[model samples]
Target: MSGQNCWGYGGDNGPLNWHKQFPFAQGDRQSPIDIVSAQAVHDADLTPISISYSACTSLSICNSGHSVMVEFEDCGDKTVVSGGPLENPYKLKQFHFHWGQRGRQGSEHTVDGKSYPGELHLVHWNSTKYNTFGEAAVSHDGLAVVAVFLETGDKHANLHRLTDALYMVKFKETKAQFKDFDPQCLLPKCRDYWTYPGSLTTPPLHESVTWIVFKEPILVSEKQMDKFRMLLFSGEEDSEKQPMVDNFRPPQPLKGRTVLASFKL
Candidate 1:
């Protein structure tokens, strides 16, 4: 995975190619934005959502162009975040990171129009209620994601174990057990979030997703920031070292959609 071997940019997994690559990922309504908002229309049927964590067998931190992600694999126990009436309830899949220059913005979702320095995405899928993410695409409420924004501050460093694996992703097939880690701590106590339907920011820009972008951002240090910059892009060259920045897709037109929130405590 360290030799330009990943295939999202110019290869099979590229954003533009996803519709064809993944059957259910099709549709003109993909996310990452530019879909202009309608009169704050309504999703009167929305459900309450929350995330729960479990154990994992292995993890991989990679420089995925969007951010240096500490990707989880064979993870244990995925909890559902949404409530009743949802056609497809979401199940935790994996978590990844998105960052920008120390002083710049990198978050994909904005609050009342505010961007942050970085964002964390907890990707989940609807289990058949769809057999695969490919199948969930057409299911209105197919996929759900919990996002946490990261800001630079003096907050205790808890993500060190995550970034420490950046070197391991270059090797691929390698595994590491990340014990006793909890994603809830990575989330701010305030659960106010901007909700909308979006797509995978990475290549294959699959549109079948319901995004829950948090309002309050978590804190990280400068060292945590540099750890992200150390990721190697699957090849032994400096140019392959394109620092992971703006892996976020520019907000798409809101296209007559409503963005909801659960901020009121």
Candidate 2:
């Protein structure tokens, strides 16, 4: 399992053994690092993240073997995130999640060694310079990902729109049309965040991401999290079935990288 091109978050194929196939897993700038607030350097010059997702068009939702992802219409820049360490506006491509088997520990990126129940990654591409997401994904400065932590608490009404559709895509390689959904409701109240350079937290683990991790976590009920756990890694046709839990990658070494903060810790 360790040498396989396709990887899962369990047993011999887990994060600890990813380096066998993905050399970047052992590379210098891996993602999901433990963000030490005390060590992060606050930069007053860092601009606020400006997101114009009011008209963001949602295309479909699919279970991409690894995680359930919601892809958007990025043919145009209707939905984009700019400012805050970004040289150009990045077009919103897709949004997905990572979680653990249980509600207590699931998020990929930790803060001061603390973990969250889940993490949301909103993937974007540098459309200004790249023709497509596939091309940008492998480029050094081609991608920007917005990461939001999910905590267990009150039910998030907005999350119901997606969770309700989870049953439609309970198995891998499944897809359903999802429309008119705006992601603003899923964001935390505060816009403050920490920024750094890192790689994708999955196989092919390209070191091409500009990560913006929010400081405050959004709330979701335990019941909602259970819905995510119900998703299966195996497709409906496969005789063997596996639940899609603990899909999150562990925090990698930060090396000598500096985490820049937009707000005071």
Candidate 3:
């Protein structure tokens, strides 16, 4: 995983071992960023976003080790990663997190001079064209996500949608009041991000994502960070460090891939 340990049924989720589980896992090579690159990007024009949250029936809210996730039903109306505009968009599906309870030890990407306690990922798919994530996995244009970094703060009054469901997701197939959620407000004021070709940070490790890492991080309070610690491996031996790391995958190799800063090339 992107953290210090692997997160699976056992300790096998480690980055070194992921390739065994999934042949495509990007455990081989990546710059292993200490994640200390949060400096303001040179030039970026953030996209206009509007996310309206409604009750999702198939949300699987659970804590594997990382942060909690509240998934939504998969509707084939997505065009988000279709390499197109929002008009013909993929339906927004699930949203999860990569987090640490305290300190900067567990961040995924090290920003310029700091690393927040965690990051949030809102997963979306392009169903308008691609029938399934499996099918989309092979195409260059498949998924689109908005990532928000969470730093320790006072207490996230607005993020109760995630915290309230922490203890409930013990087994799986769990659902909750992920009510009135919008995927837009989570973005940083600056839209200038590092756009690159990459794969899913989690399982399947599909190499079909249009990665858009925001140049800025969102605020997450200390108490808010602790909410993630509630995650368990469902057993004691899941990993020595419980809730500290969960589904984060190590950064894949730039693979000769060019990182496009929002600034002029």
Candidate 4:
């Protein structure tokens, strides 16, 4: 997906076949693992993560072939996240969603083997140690991602703004200007989460992410979820159009990784 390999979330190019192109897909630290709450260890030292997006500004939204992502201006420390197993504040880079076509089986990560309808990933980089995002992406202590699950019920006002812009970038390689969007509106009420070391769910599946998956999921109306399924995986010029749904990868093996919970349960 980074180059011209044309990786996708379908047959021949789906998650199961990714290991052929990117060996890290089968690595020990692969992400989107099923978070078995009962088996997770409670760490008293894990701090509550505080996200400050007060000064955040959205740049643009694009259909990245894999998922629809909203980019943010990570300049002047405008937006950042700290605490919760983080040694230093990480700068917000982008946020994206992974969803299923029309069911409750879309999320990449699950809890006690239960998958959500969708999931959001807020990707960040360790600016305190890395010179650039590209350099940090491959480093062991480089990236941090906050994952929030999505359930159907009520429509989210903040998310509606994004849903409205989806029409502009319906096809792959398309983008639209989306400014002044604050990501804080998307987080769940509770900050308690499960933290573990894992790799990117996409190609080049770099094993450099420190994932923080929230315990509670946010709410979205059934109508709102329908908008996400309207996106296309193929470009506008392609003869055949493939709807971009069920873009999430399945949960991988835990491989004896110690999952730390931020709060005692």
Of candidate 3, the 10-residue stretch with the lowest lDDT total is 78-87
Off by over 4 Å in 3: 1-13, 26-60, 63-67, 74-88, 112-114, 170-177, 235-247
Q: Look at candidate 4 and give me any clashing residue pairs.
A: none
What lDDT does the true structure give each of the candidates?
0.58, 0.89, 0.55, 0.89
Clashes of 2: 0
lDDT of 4 by residue, 77-110 (tens): 7689999899999999999999998867889999
The true-versus-predicted C-alpha distance at residue 19 of model 1, in Å, is 11
Count residue pairs with overlapping backbones in model 3: 25
Q: Best-fitting candidate, measured by TM-score?
A: 4
Q: Estimate each model's TM-score.
A: 0.74, 0.96, 0.73, 0.97
Q: Residue 101 of candidate 3: its Cα lDDT?
A: 42
How many backbone clashes does every candidate have?
Answer: 24, 0, 25, 0
All predictions: root-mean-square deviation over Cα? 4.9, 2.4, 5.0, 1.5
lDDT of 1 by residue, 1-265 (tens): 1112234444666545655765534545555553223323335455555555544323444444444444455333355566522355576656777666554676666554656677788877787477765676545667777888788886446677676656655422333445455666687877655677666665445566777766678888867776665553344444544444445544555656666645432
Candidate 1 local Cα displacement, residue 55, angstroms: 5.7
Candidate 1 segments whose C-alpha is farther than 4 A from its true place: 1-28, 34-47, 55-67, 70-78, 84-88, 137-139, 170-180, 237-240
Compared with the true structure, the alpha-carbon lDDT of candidate 3 equals: 0.55
Descending-TM-score candidate ranking = 4, 2, 1, 3
